[model samples]
Target chain A: MQKHFITLLFTLSLTGLNFANAYEMETTFHGVLDLRATVTDSLTGNYTQGGYGKFALNDGESFTLAQAGGEIALNWDNGLSVHAVANAYKNNGDFKLGLTEGYIKYSGLPNASGYRWQSKLGVFYPKISLENNAYAWASKNTLNSSSLNTWIGEEIRVLGNEITLTRLGRINKDPFDLSLTVSAFVNNDPAGSMLSWHGWTISNRQTLYTEKIQLPYFKARMQGYDLYEQASSSDPFLEVDDRVGGHVRAEIKFHKKGAISAGYYNNNGKPYIVDNGQYAWKTRFTHIDLTWLLPQGIVLTSQLLHGDTLMQSPLKTDVVNNDYTNGYIALSKRIKAHRITSRIERFNVKDNDKTVGDNNTERGKAFTLNYTYRLSKPWFLSTEFTWIDSYRPGRMYTNQPINLTERQLAFAARYFY
Target chain B: MFNKLPIQIKFLFISFFIIFAPSFVANATNTLTVNVVDTNQKPLENMVVYVEPIGHKVTLKNTNTLEIGQANKAFIPYISVMQLGSKVKFNNQDNITHHIYSPVGDNKFSVKIRSGQEVIKNDFNEAGEVSMGCNIHDWMSGYMLIVDTPFFAKSDKNGNTEMVIDKSGQYKVVVWHPQMTDINNRITKTINLNSAMAVTMQLSKPMDEIPSQQNEDDFDFLSDY
Candidate 1:
């Protein structure tokens, strides 16, 4: 069914492109190239190599191609547009390339009453992050994203349709604008597997649609354990229970100076269902986001998220049950051609079930400071420093410290086209 | 000597005075200066100020097409005033695409203009405030006040605009700003403008917050959000 859906989406996109050509639509291509030099001090190996480290790089100095991303858009005069973004990454002799997001959007003109409606179809990220507003879902202020947004990038992609209704404040002659959005999606039943197994992480690496995340070495996956049948790597986008999920969000914008939004998401998967070595985990969360343009050219953004996940066995017994919470506050200021940003984050996961050897309990705090200088219209130079302190009992199984502190410094050169 | 004068001579004198008296009124030139200020008495720039004759007809002048440009993801000339029936042209000066549209009254139009391209729209026939925005960039906002009369001007940085009018009688002077909290974003005062006049229009309430056109993200290479 997923294959058929993908094929149908491509077919529709082709058809739309043909129609766009006939209508003399405007097609644009934009992209960005990011290169980074990094130095890290981490005792454990990185999670990409099946270790419990938090950052993306290993414990050494290296120069790497962080990302080369491209986006193509076809916009018709009739309020319809098709957009697609793809990215490539080369890190530590490992090369990865895949599509990040593709969707068709329809934005209707505001009516006489100042109400407008828009809709999107296909695979895309949920509207939960206030930081990753740049191209290819890159964080605008810092090199690393907050824990809450990192998890969203990793596992919370929507493969369905979303509809939004907005009341434009200017046209309505009101000081406040309001919008409501609702979406229904599929192919995300295994959304919470990595969060429960590997705990929360803070990185700017977004999982591609075809990528599977590697899990850390854990005792629960060993022989004679409850999760012995679990896969070593998690396919987060797989459909295991064939159940539909839904999300609803509402926002109030103060003219255009700032906005506050709240949302609820539920992947109503039926537990105890396993398909192709992927287990269905019932996951639900509620989140709030705020973006305010403060005085003195300062931008303030923050997000708070709390959720729970459950995976059960065939006997209706809990295998992994955990409650998680993540929050962050960031402030950025721009002076002429330079910008500086700082953020503080807190995250926690509480194990609620008696799943021996599968310790999902963890707590962590992180701080990030970034400074960016605009070299030119399309070129930017940035330096960032990050510190993370975390405690996880499961790390002790691999002879690693239960309490860990890691730090990284990176300098990046970015070019946008 | 007056008593001895003929009745016809006296009647002619009175008639001449009556006939020439209205010509003096017609030839009288009125110099009007409008000062716009916020509630705190701070000068408010870019406010649209216009005078309309209440009981007389003013011929609408034919105006050249007004051009609004897009550069650095912002609309040039954030506020404008044009006569009714004038045309508007949107020019995309940046090396990017812009989808400009106004969703109000008869001025409603949506056009997609590529970089170094321009689109001319001939639908300024409506006499009302038209608010425009770029569909691609939500923060890019521009306002145009289309008035039926030709006597309209936007206030300068000092909140002053002067107009010299001949044959001005009862006139309605109005001040408009997109962010003004008044009803319809306008404040009106009816006054007789038969001589040199100065009017000060102050807001009773504070203006609504005007969103900055500068994008906080400052990234032009962004996809749809």
Candidate 2:
């Protein structure tokens, strides 16, 4: 099915290109290349390798091609457009590439009464992260994203349709603008598996559509356990239950100074349903975000998210029940070609069910400081330092310490075109 | 005899009068210089100042088409002033697309311009401020004030702008700025421009902050949010 989807996307893009030339439509292409050198003193392996570490890079020093991404947009004169983004990453000589998002959008002009309507159809990320404003969902302020946004990038993507309504302020002589967005999605029933199994992690690695993330070692995966039939890998974008999910977000923007938004998301999956080794994990969350442009070129941003997830057995028995919360505060200032940013984050997961050998409770705090200098129009140099202290009792099952403190320093060169 | 003179002599005589004619006109006309300042006494720039002759009709000069271009995902010349019934051209000079629109009544228009393309809008038949923005880039804002007369100039960095009126009697002077914290973003003063005049207009309240157009990150290549 994934292969077929890819083929369809390619066909649609090719047809759009042909129409662009024949109809004099607009077509634009953009891309970015990033390279990174990192040094870390983490005692545990990185989470990408199924370890409990809170970073994308593992212990020791390494040079890596962080990401190379390309995006294409075909725009028609009648407020219709098609967009797609593909990304590639190389770490430790291992390479992966896939599409992150592809969608068709329609943005209608404001009417006489100042009302505008817009809609999108396909696969895309929700407008949740205030940090990942750069290309390919990368953080513009820092090399490492906040824990709240990291989880969003890792597990949250919608494969459906969304509609938005906005009332522009300037048209009516008002000082504030208001917008509301609602979406219904599918193929995301297994959304909260990683947050439950691995606890919360802090990284900038966004999962590709066709990728499956490895989970940390747990006794439930062993023979003669309640979850012995569970898959070792979690497919975040799979449709285990044939049910649809929904999200609603509302935002108020005060001119160009800043904006505040609140949203609710629910993937109404049947917890007891399992298909092809993947279980339906019913998940729901509420989130709030604030971005304020303070005086003297300083910007302050914050996000708070709280949610719960549940997975049960065919016998209506509770297998995994967890409640999680994450929040972050960040400040950034730009001085000429240099930008400095600092952020603090807190994350927690509470295990409510007593599933033997599957302890998903964890608590963590993190700090990040980043400095970026613009080398030229298309080039940038950035250095970042990240420190995290986390406690997860689940690590004890693997004969590891329950509490761990990890630190990493990285320098990156990025080019945008 | 003057009409029957040699063509060279007639041309020289006409040239001499044409060269010195501006001094004669300068003596009869009045030069009005308006200076604007904020409450903190800071010189305000980009303020539009114009004078309308009361109880009289004046023929407006034919104005040229004004151009507002998009580059680096920002609108060049954030503010523009044009004569009523004149045309304005929206140009997209960047390697991207921009959807420019204005919601003002009677002057409302929306057009999507691609890279290196231009869209001409001539439906600005009303005299008012037309605020424009790119639907895609919400931070991109611009204003075009359409005045009934051509006797207007935007303030310079020193907060000074000058206009010469051929007939200087009973003129209504007005100052406008988008960020001005005043009713209708305007201040009107009725004065008799019988002689050369210098007017100083100070705002009673502080001006609102002008939003910055520069983005924190140099990610203009990104297609969507």
DockQ for candidate 2, please give it.
Answer: 0.33
Error of 2 at A221 (Å): 1.3
Q: In CAPRI terms, where does candidate 1 land?
A: acceptable
lDDT of 2 by residue, A179-292 (tens): 999999887888898998887777678888888898889888789888887888888888888899999999998865789999999988899999877999999999999999
lDDT scores for all predictions?
A: 0.85, 0.85
Best by DockQ: 1
lDDT tens digits, residue span A1-417, model 1:
357446846976886977776787878788878899999887547766567778777888878888788888788888888888888887767889988888888998877777889999888887898887778888777877888888888899878889999887767667677999999998788899888877888777788888888888888888998988888788888778888999999999874478999999998988899876689899999999998989996989999999999999877799999899999999999898999999999999999999778898899999999999999988989999999999999888789889999999999998888
Q: Against the true structure, what is each candidate's TM-score?
A: 0.89, 0.86
Clashing pairs in 1: none
DockQ values for all predictions?
0.41, 0.33
Give every collision pair in model 2.
none
Which runs in model 2 stand beyond 4 Å of their true positions? Answer: A1-4, A7-23, A43-45, B1-45, B51-56, B71-76, B91-95, B114-118, B155-162, B167-223
